[model samples]
Target: MATSNRPNAPELDSACVAAYDHAVRQGVFDDSDVAEQLALGEAEVLRIRTVLTDLRLLIRGEDGSATVPASPEIAEAELSAHLEAGIIERREQLARIHRQMRSLAPVYRAHRHLPQASQSVRLVEDPAAVRRELAAATRACTSEAFTVQPGGGRSPEALNEAIARDTTMLKRGVTMRILYQHTVRANLATRTYTRKVTELGAEVRTAEEIYERLIIFDRSLAFVPQERVGGRPPGAAIVTDETIVGHLWRMHDKMWQSASPYDPRDVDYASTSEEIKASILRLMATGLKDDVIARKLGMATRTCRRYMAGIMDELGATSRFQAGVRATSLGMVKPDPNP
Candidate 1:
C-alpha cells in the first residue's frame, strides 16, 4: 500500500489505538467484529480505521479492507521517521521566518531613535502603547524590578497575568520587590500569589498606605501614572532621566524599609489594624470624609465607617470631630495644623 503523504494527519487517540490493539491480538482485521467487541458505533469504527491508516499502523489489502496490523517495530520506525521529517520542516520554516524578520531589525532600531522615543521623559497617553512599552522594558530588565501597587487586592485575572510576567523575570534571575497596601494581607488570592512568588525568591511587603503606583526597572527606567484628573483618560509617564530615576529608586527603597514583610501565616493583623486606624485618624484630623479615607487606605467606605465607629467607641467620643480631638489629646494622631 502507498504511504500517506499527509504529514499533519490526525493523531491516534486511546479508543482508536485500543481498536488497533484488538485487531492485532485477533490476528485478523474485522471491523464489524472489532466494533461488536469494543462496543463502538459503525462511524466510530470507520474513524478508527481512517486514523490507523493515516498513521501507517494498519496494512490494507488491494480491496481497501484493513487486513493486517503493521508490526510494532516497523510501525514505530515509520512513525518516528515521519515525525522527525515534520520537525525538520517546521524548523526550516521558522528559520526562514526569523531571517525575514531579522532583515527589518535595523529599520526598527532607526525608528527607535525618534524624538519621543529618545526623550528623557515621555507622556504615554495611549493605554495600548503604555502596555507595549512596559512589556518591552520588562523584557530588557536585567538586575531588579520594584513595584508599588496601591490597592487592597488585584483581580484574579490581573494577578494571573502578573504572575506569568513575574515568573519569567524571576526565572531570568531578576530581583523583584513588590509593595502593596496592607489590605492585601486579608485577600486570599493575593496571598496565594505572594506565596508563589516568594518561593521563587521575590520579596513582597505591605504598608498602611502607598503614595502611588510605580514600577522601576534596574534603577534606570521608571513608569508612573499621570496625576489623575477628572474627565481625562489614564496615562503613564516613562522616566529615563538618570537623576529622576535615581530619586524614584531611593524613594522606593525608603518605602520598602518602612513596609512590613508579607507572610500569609505570620501577618501581625493587630499591628496592621492599628496602623490603618492611625492613618484613618490622621486623615480624619485633616477633615477628610469616610469615602476619601477609604480611597486612600484601599477599603470600602462602609468598612471605613465601621472602623471609624470602633475608633470613636475606643476614644469615648460621640462625633468624628470629637474623635479626632480626643485622638490628638491621647497622642494617637498629630493635630492637622491647616485645619
Candidate 2:
C-alpha cells in the first residue's frame, strides 16, 4: 500500500529537499541525526523517507546509512512549487491594496470642498473701527504686545488713543515692546510719551529706517496698513490670522534685537556729540548739501552748521577742506564706495 503524505506537505517537502541537497554535497547522514536536525517526528521522517524513495532520490549504503541522490527533477519540482505559492500571495496582496484605496475615495472627495465650507473673512473700514477692533482683540490677550511705528509722528489724537490703551494694558500686567524711527529721539512729544510708557515698564527702541507700521498682540493678532497715509484717507488695515501674526512678530523681534534702547534723561553728552559727528560724516560721504543733510537728519540748518563747527573745532581746522581732511584722518568718516 502507498503511504499518506505528511499533513504539512509543502513545508515538509521544502525542508526534505534542502536536507537532501546538503546530504548529497556532504555524502553522509544518519537517519536519526537527520530527524533531530529537521525537528521532525519519527512518523513525519518516515513519510519523507517514503516520498524520497518514490522519487528514486534516496540512496542506501553498505552500512545501512541513508543519503540523498542528486536528481535535477526533484529540485525543479520544489522550485516550481515555491514560485507558484509566491505568485498567489502577491496577487492577494495587490487585491487588498486596491480595496484600501477604494475605501478612501469618499474622504478624498470631501477634502476637495472643505475650503468653500470655511467661514468668510470680514473687512474693517474706518480707522476708528480698526482701532476699536484692535483694542478689543488685545484686551483679552494673556501675553505680551509688540508695535512698530514708522515715521514716528502720528496725529495727537491717534497718539493719545494708543497711549491710553497701552496704559490700561500695562496696568493689567501685559508686557509691551515698541519700535520707532531714530527721528523720534529728537521729538519732544515722542520723548515724553516714551518716558511715560517706560515708567510703566514697556521697552522702547529706535532704528534708522522703519518702512511701515505694524502691531502684534500676544503674538497671535497683527495689523498692517494697506496704503500709504500721506495726507489722505487712511488706507485699509490688514487684520491678520495667527499664522501671519506670528511671522510679523518674528520680524519685529529681529529689528528689536538690532535697535538701541531708549534711555530717557541720561545726559550722555559725549555719545550725543559722537552721534552728531557720525551723522555729519554720513551726510558728507553721501555728497549731500548741508541743507539736505539737515532735513534728512531731522535737524535745523543752523543746528547742522553748529555740528559742523564742533567737528572743525574738535579737529582744529579753519576751512571746510581742512575739516574734511582732518575728519577722515581722525577716523571720524571712512569712505563708503557704495554710499
Candidate 3:
C-alpha cells in the first residue's frame, strides 16, 4: 500500500471519494468503526463497501468473509487489466458479427434492390425494424431524399439525431428536400436547425398543413406511417412500388411548390401568425372541431381553441358559427362549396 506510487483514482462521488480516502488512511476494514468515523448509517456504509468492491478497491479473502482495502495502485492495475480483457473480448465479438453479416451481404443486396411483385410493399410492424430499414434506405440513396415531417416542432433530440444523417447525405452530394407545417416557424430549435441545414444545400419549406409523414429516397423507395388499428403501436410501411412511389413524389412536389421557403432571419412573425389564423379560420369554416383543426394544423387543441377565441373576437362574433359566417363574408376564407 505505497501512496507514493498510487495512480489517481477514477472520478467517483464525493462520499465514495471520502470513504476511499478514509480507507487508505485507516488501512483497515471495520464497518462499525468506519460508520462512526464518517457519521454514516449502516446502509450507507454497506453501499460504499459494495461500490468499492465493484471498483476492485475492496478485496475479500478466499473465504469471502474477510474484507481488506486494496492499495490504490493494486486496485487501478487490476481494474485496468479487467477492462482491457473486456475490450479484447468485445472487439473479437464485434469482428465475428461483422464476418457473419458480410457473409450475407450479397443476399441482402440481391433482394433489397430487386422489387418483385410480392416484395413491393413491406409492413415493418416493429419500431426497431423500421429504424433499420430507414437506415438502410438512407445509405442506399444516391440521387435525392425527400421528407415530410408533419408534427411541427420536432424534439431537439430528434433534430440533433437528424442533423448528422442529413449532413452526411449532403456531403455525399445527394439533394435533400424537407417539408414541415408552418407551426415550426414558432419553434426556436426548428428555426435554428433550418438555418444550419439550409447552409449545407438542403431545401426546407413549410406549408399550412401536411396530410401525413413521408420519407422518400431517389423516387424509388419510400417510408410512410403504417395505418393504426386496435390500439396497435405505430410502425412504418416501406414502399418500393414504382407507381405508388411516383404518386407520393408527385404529391410531395405539389406541396413543395405551394410551401414557403423557410429562412430563420427572414421570417415575418406577424405574417406567419396571420397565416396560421387564416388557415384555422378556413378549417373552422368547414365545421371542423377544435381538436381536428389542431391536429391538422399541428398544434395542441388548447392552442387551437385560444386561436379560435382570438379570431372570433377580432371578427366581432360571439360564437364559432357567427365567426365563420363573417369570415366568409369578408373573403377571409372561401365558402365551403358543399355547404
lDDT of 1 by residue, 1-339 (tens): 234466576787999879888988987678899899999999999989888877777887667754778876887798788778777887888898989988997887566554555567877877678878888888889999999999688889778878988988999999999999988887888988999899999999888778789999999999998776895546798999999999999977988997888876665578888878888899988888888899888988998999999999999999999999998888999543223
**Model 2, residue pairs in steric clash:** none
TM-score of each: 0.72, 0.50, 0.66
What local distance difference test score does each model get?
0.85, 0.69, 0.83
Q: Which has the better TM-score: candidate 2, or candidate 3?
A: 3
In candidate 1, position 292 carries an lDDT of 88
Task: Give lDDT tens digits, candidate 3, residues 200-319.
Answer: 899988888888899999999999987666666468878889999999999789889989888776767888899899998999888889999998899889988999999999999999
TM-score of candidate 3 against the unseen true structure: 0.66
The residue pairs in collision within model 3 are none
Candidate 2 residues 1-339, lDDT tens each? Answer: 223333433334796786676667767645686687778788877777776665556757667654646465865586567556767877888898989987997886465343323211234457777777787766876678888887634556676777888888898999999888665676677777778889999998876446567877777666776664576546344545666667778877888888778775654545545665776776665567888777655566887789888777877888667777767777778554223
Worst 10 residues of 3 by lDDT: 1-10
Ranking of candidates on lDDT, top first: 1, 3, 2
Question: Which regions of candidate 3 are displaced past 4 Å?
Answer: 1-103, 106-117, 228-233, 335-339
Instruction: Flag the better candidate by lDDT, 2 or 3.
Output: 3
